[model samples]
Target chain A: MNWIVNNGDLIGQLVVAHLATAIPPIILSFFLSIPIGWFANRFQVSRGILLTVFALLYAIPSLPLFIVLPLIIGTGLRDPINVVIALTIYGIALMARSTADGLASVDPDVRQAATAVGYSARSSFWRVELPLAGPVLLAGIRVVAVSTISLTTVGAVLGIDSLGALFTDGYQRNIPSEILTGIVVTIALALAVDFLIVRIGRLLMPWSRIVGAGGGRSARRQRTAATA
Target chain B: MNFLIQAFAFIFDPKHYGTANGIEVRLGQHLLISFEVLVIAALIAIPVGYLIGHTGRGRAFAIGFSGGVRALPTLGFMILIALGVGIGLGAPIVALVVLAIPSILAGAYSGFEAVDRRTVDSARAMGMNELQIVAKVEVPLGLPLLIGGLRAASLQVIATATLADYVGGGGLGRFIFAGVQTQDYPQMLAGSILVIFLAIASEILFSIIQRLVVPAGVTAGRPKDVRVKSSRSRAALG
Candidate 1:
């Protein structure tokens, strides 16, 4: 652990860089996917095409995407933003599927009930549909958060700097401790972020917490199945 | 667009196709590593997953383990293993196998888990042995989901196998890494394209297999079910 102690400041900086690189894509993808997901859900005709495209997008390896993205977007080869943009694309691809599935999971009868109560399309969506879709959306976002956080390290290969920098540096220097630290920290950060998302979800959707508390195994199964 | 042309040119150049480090050779290496890792991981994981799914005995542990595995950074794993083992196929193979195991395990068991319990009960009612039931009932019913798991595992392995080059475990990733050092954007892009092509080819191959494997009567609902569950692996896709 002397490596960590001697490199405390460097570790701190890398952690910050990692978060900066990871969080934007997580947040951006979560918000952007909701609408795209809604469109897919709203227009049944487009659902298949949209999902297939996103799935293909996700299937592209991150390194190649990182290499080719600059060509498409004109970022410099080593630009940190290239990593961010590529990750956002992946996050959207993933979250869009989740969002569409989340939005689709809403009960039609409940939506009709909201309409009968005089909620407009927009109002009902924000109020009735979005809230009802919260559990699945939350699950989707959690996955996005974890995966994006883990993926931010790929930027290190390109010399863009992040927690992943430790990996390359450690490998070059033959410092296993540093690589271990990066792996542990990355996983910790992901799980911690996931925990924070869950906490925030509980706070924002108090009713879900209540259902979670009372609904027992069946509700839990339904949630898993929804995301499934 | 210019780089795209350069990349295609790099890919098509006959001069780049045959030597020790040729695209074809690296591509073959890439596929070989991925195939070996997948086969080994499947051999290990599928049975454990099957037990978990069949008995419902370790579902929670399986989920927790896979979820945690998903959170791991592939680059970190590769670097660490390569350092530990002094750089060889052992490192990449070990790392990639670890990466492949979770999805396959998830698939094998979840495939069994997804089977209707009532069907198992009926099979039992018919005096079928556990092995016979699994073979005739659970395996047949769960083939699509099992295949879905394999497909996801294959994609992630193929994609990450590119990184195998990072640690001297050579693959198509050689082009990407070699190009990066020389600033040969075309080579890097070409490597990426080749990997993407492999991923897509496997995807199509699996989808067709997934379709063909479904027991005839259950075809209507199983494909869609498999599609939705395909989301499980994206968490580990990175």
Candidate 2:
């Protein structure tokens, strides 16, 4: 108790730093993935290669990625940039898949109708496709958001600032409370962000809500859509 | 680059491969922890998951539970437990098992859920009991997903198990952590390469098992586009 209280200011600073390290990559991936995903979906052959490569990247463990970043980027061991850049790479991999999956979920019939109604290919993507893909995209973002927050805690071992710092501090000092606090705070942050994103998704995709709330066969359909 | 050459050299050097502190022992330790945890997790998760899937109850609970399990930062949990448990094998093994149970549970239940209602009905019409239906119909059908959950759980456990060194448990992670401490980047890279290789190898192994076990009809009927693991992955509520 005294540890968290006495270190409240320190914890606050670490939380801010944690957010700083985690949030940008999500934003960056959200923008970058649109083109990346578009290109992947556009070229069916290349999609396999691109997706495989990113999934491979995703398979690389977090600590090793952190360790490897300095050698690749010429950053010092403690550079916050090391953590940021590594996480950004992960975020991109995650978001790109989501974007591709989201884009693919768009109904071809809908696209044909939009085209028949005088929408250009470019505008049709922005106007018809992107909006419709919002729910799954949001689902993907929620995943990236939660995992990224949790992963930033891993950054502490690399000496980048974050809630993970508390964990490291706790480990070194043998204070379980500090580590407990870090775990609690990080989990709470992730859950809150996930909830907020889901709410936003529900708000944006009111049709899902309408269909879900409707009677008969809708329940099964909703589950299929969810699991799909 | 010279780094890659050096790393490959370090990895292949005979000196790194034999003895208690060597790669062999480390790999064994790593696999041992991963294996034990996976066994433990399967025992717990599979039954609960199978029951839920069979009964068609607790769908919401299963979703939330899986998310909660995955959202836990494994490193944090391991280290926190290590503090109390004094950095022995106890902490890491428990932590890894905890990290593993969700996917297995989700995979098991979802697999059962995926069994067609009519298939079970016909079996019942033929006078087969519930146990017979599960053993004969659902098990055969759900085998692929059950394997998938195992595959997913194993991959996760194996990859993350390398972090065991951080908690003072022995594993392949020793190379990465030790190399970092000594500024031996090549050794660290080599450790990472081994980790990646292990993951890929296991993935291949699981894919083969999935192909072998899944009913021929299931594979022939469906394209490989379903998101059984990732979708059930539940945005992993932090």
TM-scores vs. true structure, each candidate: 0.95, 0.91
Query: Which 10 successive residues of model 2 chain A have the least lDDT summed?
Result: A215-224
Looking at model 1, residue B12 earns an lDDT score of: 97
**Two-chain complex of model 2, DockQ on C-alpha atoms against the true structure:** 0.50
What's the C-alpha lDDT at position B238 in model 1? 46
The C-alpha stretches of model 1 lying farther than 4 A from their native spots are: A216-218, B225-238
Candidate 2's chain A scores what TM-score? 0.91
Query: Model 2, range A121-200, lDDT digits (tens) per residue?
Result: 99999999988777667767877888888888887766788998888888988889999999998898888878887897
Put down candidate 1 lDDT per residue, A165-186, tens digits, no spaces.
9999999998899999999999
lDDT of 2 at B214: 65
lDDT of 1 by residue, B171-230 (tens): 998998999899888888999899999999989899999889988778533768123342
**Best candidate according to DockQ:** 1
**Candidate 2 local lDDT, residue A99:** 83
